[model samples]
Target: MPNLYFCIPKNDAVYFDEHEVTHMKVMRIKEGEIIDATDGNGGKYKVIVKEIGKNEAHGNVLNYEFVAPTDGRLVLFAPSGRWERLRWTIEKAVELGVDEIYVFNNEHASRHYDDKQEKLELIVREASKQCVRYHFPSIRSIEFLDIFSIAPESTYILDFKGRKIPKRISKSVGIIAGPEGGFSKKEIKLLKERFKSVCLGKKILRFETAVILSTGIFAMKLGKI
Candidate 1:
């Protein structure tokens, strides 16, 4: 098999027209040479060069394969930590392959990020390309409890207040962590009523540590990793 290059269209033989032909011919690739291509849609294609002309090159289509982009679950991450930790969490979350991320700016939240979503998105993009993944996770702007209430089901809040860590994985999960000062009593109560609060054992964890650990453990339980 030849080296691979990612392009827009996927799962078909590529006809190297003009520019591409010049590129390949200049590189001295011969007829019948195999090449690989990806469509950035979780699919890969292998093709064999059939003809190489001055201005164009045609290929014989070969087999194709795909890896599903969307994992079975939708994940919601409520931002509640410090800068260094939150940034680290975002990177790890992208590496772990969370579907969606939301940074919640609670009334009592400690850290306020000016461009948290943008920073995290850059991290996800780099991680995605490094992993050769066609799709990258989505990160939304900072929000509050009022915004979170309407989110999809299967929500989980990673709080130390609850008993026992979560063990089972479902179709979707939303994890909420508090700030350094922790959530206000009212915030805790409201979240408990709206979303299930999950404990991460006896030891109290820093906001950033908790965020990364919670998502990592959740994926492990779901067998996604």
Candidate 2:
């Protein structure tokens, strides 16, 4: 497969952003070379590089394909913790086909890091490119209680004490993974009241481990993996 890049299409051409231009320079991509690109929506393109300027690269579209969006949404609700661990979780989640991610704060969270939206989005974008994903995932931070606004019936909490994952699930579903220290009693009570819970296994796992494992399992049930 040709190396995949990302661009926004305008008229019959596509313009690569600064990040992509830098990537092209690093890869020694030259004018007239054919490459694959996606708009991070559903459009994929075959393009011939036309020009590489100081800040951006331009290409002429040779062919275009539009992929239909996936059938269901797989949303992940993760707790805020160490930056390195959280970053790894985000990258792995995107590669595993998570549709959206929400990083939240809770009572038992080990540590709190200021939400750097730009850096987080950058990580998501790069992960999408690396995985050659046609549709990129959206991510943001939220408070623990904010989950109430989502469809509680379709949301699940990951806990070792909870029931095993169901063979079937709703088309749109969300999975919530607690922090390193686990959810406080009050938080657990509130969650059990509103959301269903699923167990990955008998053994406990780190927050990031739970996020990735639960995502892969749900994606498999959804036939996305």
The estimated TM-scores of all candidates read 0.66, 0.91
- Model 2 — TM-score against the truth? 0.91
Q: Alpha-carbon error at 218 in model 2, in Å? A: 0.9
lDDT for 83 (candidate 2): 82
Q: What is the C-alpha lDDT of each candidate?
A: 0.65, 0.85
lDDT of each residue in 1-225, candidate 2, tens digit only: 236888989999999988889889888999999988999998989999999998899999999999887889888887888888888988899888998888888887776544588777888888988988989898887788888885436889898888888888899988988788878899999999998889888998867677778899898888676
For candidate 1, give the lDDT of residue 51: 86
Looking at model 1, report the run of 10 residues with the lowest lDDT sum: 1-10
Going through the candidates in the order shown, the clash numbers are 0, 0
| Candidate with maximal lDDT | 2
* lDDT at 97, model 1: 66
